[model samples]
Target: MNEPISWVVAYPEIFLLVMSAVISLVDVGVKSRLRDTTYVLSLLTLAVVAYLLGASAASGETLRSFNNMVVSDPMGQWLKCFAALAMFATLVYGRRYAGDRDMLARGGEMFSLALYALLGMFVMISGHNFLVIYLGLELLTLSSYALVALRRDDPQAIEAAMKYFVLGALASGFLLYGMSMVYGATGSLDLAEVLKAIAGGEATLKGSAQVLVLGLVFVVAGLAFKLGVVPFHMWVPDVYHGAPTAITLMIGGAPKLAAFAIVIRLLVEGLLPLAVDWQQMLAVLSVVSLLVGNLAAIAQTNLKRMLAFSTISQMGFMLLGLLAGVVAGDSGNMANAYSSSMFYVITYVLTTLGTFGVILLLSRNGFESENITDLAGLNQRSPLYAGVMAICMFSLAGVPPLVGFYAKLSVLQALLASSHPLYIGLAVFAVMMSLVGAFYYLRLVKVMYFDAPTQTADIVAGADARSVLSLNGALVLVLGIVPGGLMTLCAQAIAALLA
Candidate 1:
């Protein structure tokens, strides 16, 4: 406690940075063409990183380091821990798939890049400065662009990468411009100073207030792109459909936890004074994303594309928690509302990992299980796989006895508990949308259990994938049954943030 383990919070990031370089070097000399050494080393690095972050989270220190450019607290540390572990799960579910596709043929840049991406998420989560957060966002997005095109020979992948890069660059520019405006108005690059400046009525001079609001608009737009919300969500479905399934999971899973962290850091912690304007923006985006995403998902025959739309809707749902927090400008509901969002995001990622894990397992060298029909007769081929998929689907559908149900419930509770009629109306609308969403989820389940066999092959998978997958699916069900622990953890994390 004297030295403040997370007080020196950069330790784990420094370790991850060095280990990534070492692993890359080691992969080059292996001479075996296989990436096992690189994969194993990467996993070890992530495990250690998770341990470090967990220790820091348990320490419960709200320490600011790097000249107050970064703040390490329970929320950031726990998010980092989960991000590292999610990356661990990603690599485990992906290694064989990558190997079979010759993705690791030249080397294991994928593993190293993924680690760097996690490092970026760490920076984004803990950053207390606008520029620091932007830096982390760029690192993660750039890494993601490269990863989407890792299967260089595939035209779809190459196209996806190009689209991601161009759109990502544009979003970054919007965010940077917005930050500059915010800085000009408030005269600070640090988030805390910005908040202090705004709260003190320093920006109320006519021109300054206008500029601040304009900047908030652009910032929200940029964040919408990052969160893959409506109107700014053009990149998600294409990228999700075209990238290698493993890479898709990488995009769809851990980064979301980081995205939520940044949302909390920027909107909740940094710009709470401007809540009224930004909250309205979030509400519109959430409603449109829900409407578009679910309707589009039902039309998709391809499993990946369908899930891509699902991601859009789910993200919109998560935003409900954020927008609900500042109702009537009262900060009383802030912790509970944001904590529900935190829990929703964590559970969403958990379910996403298992969902895509099943996709990767069904895929092999000559085949990609890209279509929903590919899942037909899954129960007949492997009941274990089918059951896991079903659990994830049910969770997504908000069906009972699964994690997704509780996640939706918590968000709804946060909404309904509010005094605002608008929030209650949105809650009802969300329930109706959930009903629309259930059709697609249940359709998948029906295809798995009742549809006629399309292929006679029994499913094959490595021991590691099977074990992790079982645990992942079990958590979805068990957490649904008993979500108190995680709910408490999320509430505590948010308390640290708000404190």
Candidate 2:
């Protein structure tokens, strides 16, 4: 008898896929420069998908579908749920901005492409096999390249897209080469089978241990590139700087959750048997990312570029949690450590949304808010937007009582809680990096508050964008104050992953 493939386990991906095609078709008939029709439909699609993922997560059932090539688990579901909501918010904040820049003048391609990119992220999060994961990643990256080049008339956008495409292709090649080697060693493409092959010493006994290790290095290198960590993060600043601000958010925001998902799926779930080897590798990446990201950010006049480096440093801190998960070969601290990283990523995304929302709001027709000085006297123009931006800045700075502080605290706690000398030392080093990072974040705040307004034009935003932006900022503050609910959710989701 043939094995049955469970199609129902991937309800959200199915819905998203179907809706993306439908939306694309529907967009062909859309003539509005604002893309209102496609925008509304896309929002509805994202909302429904998010609901489905949330409902599935709430059910707490782990199911393998498509002959075990796809898995629906709490960890995946929660991440998918968040990614969907982040997409929804991105559209909300970027809709008017895109329309203003003629991004929607031709059709609703941006909206549809965004949905496609999100579909890619969904696949990435839910994929249970090496091929599936790589396919998902390609889908997301390819869509992103097109999205970056959407402003075909802009030379900078085209240049950035070219850079992104070239680097992204190289990274994909690294991952594929690594996957092939891994397959040669383990004789399996399925993550579970790969895990069994490695953990059971099948590869070692077959004299493929060295090959597996070499493959792991390439895999980690590919993953590091995807995560935009140091040494592999060349594309981050240029892409963030060159792309339209709205496109920047699309690239920077939700894909992070998906990136985190793949790290877990590939490293934590598949090759955890070799934690000791990967652990040291991750530690070095983390330390270098913190050093380079923070220091380089200090020299940036472009807000987008600064945030890009900030992202690199923030990811470094999250990686620290992953490294601390395995201490002296004892898996006792695994759940807490990974959960802390999860918490950090979620909170970071939430803050990024708010920060970018403000930037989008401040930008008017013929004016792009791309520089630090663009925020000067923002408080005078609109206190609400200023407050939102300030909150985001403070959160990103890891200032007290904000969600970012707690996010950093949780990661530091995970590191220290491991009771390993190296991890403890990392905790200290991370703290020092955060202090260095604060200077840039606070510098923006100072400009927003103290400097004179360069333009007296009224700050205008649609009702939807304003409401959502406010809510986004409020959540950052509220979550910081009461983080237990999210913390518990992350812990349970990670626990489910381990189980």
Candidate 3:
């Protein structure tokens, strides 16, 4: 008999969908009465969804629904919870910034669209079917494109949106074509069935192997664009520089966790048999990203653009953990390797949230804080904000006693444990690139601390943003000091995924 379908497995997504629609309608009615009402409602919605995810994670049981197209598991639940929390923190940092710039003046569209994007991320995390995953990806990307152009009056924002849309559509096409090829090769869209076909051995020696490999190439290309790695990273700097600071934070922060989840789901879960092929490709990509991303970032004067390049290099470190997962086809180290990547991604996102949060906090109406020179003498203006930004920069530089250090160390450990000469060399190169990257981050710190104030205007930010920014920085430090718990959790989640 077929297994009974359970809608309860998708309760969090269902709730978010319904609440998002309700909030959209409610915004039309109550937005004029109270300017911040929709914001409060959006926060409450995220809080409830987070609670549901937490409860499910605590249950420690995987549940599937809709013919296993949707799954509820510890990995998905935890990622979803964090994604929501990141969105919450993003809104907290963005509200005042948005209000001053007239982005939040009309209604709750900004909040609702963000909620929709969160809903898309949740679906992406839980989706077990290729079609479902694609659907979720479209939802997220479309929302992102719209969010980027929210400031329609700005030519830069509109131009950025056009570039994003054109490139995004092409990437989607690449992914879809790849998916079609995979389906043709395996005669199944279901990942498990495709795996069975590949593992069964008849498919590899046949004519289908070539097609499968070709499809894999396109898929990886599409994914690399999303990850903003070098050679596929042209859009990142433009988008980051063009969009408003608030939208930039939204784009940079939580979506990365979603990207990591999809990579795990599609590559690691669905296509492990082809690791040798993709591993080589990823090795090249990682090296190029580290080299180009770090070198390019050093020349950028715009803080947003510089961070965009920084993100590309950081993704290289995350890829190192991924490539370490399969050495000589020995699957014994897969869980630890993948878990390290997960931990790296999560920590990177956490650090990114705080870093961008500080940027947003420093911004005010009519004055965009896009230039690194704008940060001159930040310490003199607001010591607390400057300190938070410093912590974020230090963490990103992999300085000792910060979460980024531990995150990078874990990935390097995974690479070293592989006992491969090539990987060992790559790790050494990564360390060197990191040292180069540190010069820029530390240079920014020097400007904030030692340089004279460029803008004598007083910096004003609310209590909520200040408090959350402090906590965000503290977590980065605390997690570095005691990373055992999060590391174990990531390991357990990856183990469950493999099982």
Which prediction has the highest lDDT against the true structure? 2
Query: Cα lDDT of model 3 overall?
Result: 0.89
> On residues 273-391, what C-alpha lDDT tens digit does candidate 1 reach at each position?
99999999999999999999999999999999999999999999999988778888788898889999999999999999999999999998789998999999999999999999999
Q: Is candidate 1 or candidate 2 better by lDDT?
A: 2
The runs of at least 3 residues in candidate 3 whose Cα sits more than 4 Å from the true structure, single-residue gaps closed, are: 32-34
TM-score of each: 0.98, 0.99, 0.98
lDDT per residue, candidate 3, 1-499, as tens digits?
6578898998899899999999899888774522477888888999899998988886778888888788888999999999999999999999988888778767767889999999889888898888998999999999999999998788999999899999999999988888888888888877777787887865676679999999999988888888888788999999999998889988899999999998888888778899998899889889999999999999999999999999999998899999988899897789888999999999999999999998898888889887999999999998988998999999999997999999999999999989989989999999999999999999999999999999877778877788889999999999999999999988888888899
Model 2 residue 335 CA deviation (Å) reads 0.3
Local lDDT at 37 for model 2: 86
Error of 1 at 86 (Å): 0.8
Candidates in descending lDDT order? 2, 1, 3
> lDDT tens digits, residues 342-374, model 2?
999999999999999999988989999889988
Model 2 scores what on Cα lDDT? 0.94
